[model samples]
Target: MNKNRVRLRCTYHGCELKQTGGIPYLAPYFDPLLQLLNIEVLDSSNHWKLFSKHALVHYGKQFARLGKLKRNDVIELTAQLRKDGSFVYPAHVRLLTNGPRREKIPESRTELIGYVMTQNGLYHLGGKYEYPHYVNQYENWLNKKDSTADQSKAESSSITPNQSYCHHHYGTHGNEKKGEK
Candidate 1:
């Protein structure tokens, strides 16, 4: 057996049976593009995934050091086996990025990008998570402003007194009655 090949033990309660036929595991990392945890895999069909506890500790430390993983940071996967003859891969991992930036926006939003590790290979997490981009937010703000302006115009027009109706029906043009009739 190749020393690098992951070793596994039978997961029966009170029954300690080491097995060599277990599946490989690949840990996942944060993917900014997908805005979720993604795993890179050498082969997805191999049933490779992450070890939960290891992933948590690894990402916890990473988050502390880097603040948050944005997208495209390289993440490595570790393996683990369960007692029910099943497996649980890492569902989450830390965000590793180039560096942190203090955004100019008043809300203090930032962006980070990193890579995700999978059983197949390392994959790049895209720029979907970069904060302070503001394109979407700006569009929404503009739309609201336009809507409010339209509403104000409509309200002003509707609130005007019925001067035209009074003049045509009752000839009530305040001191100009003789000429108007």
Candidate 2:
């Protein structure tokens, strides 16, 4: 019954959440709980931005499926991220975790090219591209798709080098070649 930890079917943040209604209580506890896990805060400068870097990294983005990313979930997900990571916005966290049975949360293709939420407040994560590699990857993927499609077309077109041969590959008729009937 810690006033700090938001619980399932419990009221916190002045929001009355009922059980059957399936409201996510763990949503709000994510940040405060994450802080308790790590030893010290890394960089106080634009905390949320730094956290976004961690959260959107390989693991964080995966767990951003609502309820699935609970306080404990965030604790494990970040295992490294900290300093009041979840203190940003419970709704935003829900956008990431969304959990099971809740509306399935969609992964974003939008580059992390904007401000991100954190414990202290909003912070810029990918000033232009945080790491900038994702954009390259997406571009590479598009290229590969285009190349594969071109190759497929080339292969299909080459099926018959001689158009006449392809169209007149006559089958046997009454044990004799075509026109012998």
The models' CA-based lDDT, in order, is 0.33, 0.31
lDDT of 2 by residue, 37-115 (tens): 2222223352332233222223234333442233433322223323554332222222322355642222333221111
Stretches > 4 Å off in candidate 1: 1-133, 161-181
Each candidate's number of clashing pairs is: 20, 14
* Candidate 1 accuracy as TM-score: 0.19
Query: What are the per-residue Cα lDDT tens digits for candidate 1 across 70-99?
Result: 334544433343544333443333333335
Off by over 4 Å in 2: 1-128, 161-181
TM-score of each: 0.19, 0.22
Winning candidate number (lDDT): 1
lDDT of 1 at 108: 18
Error of 2 at 126 (Å): 11
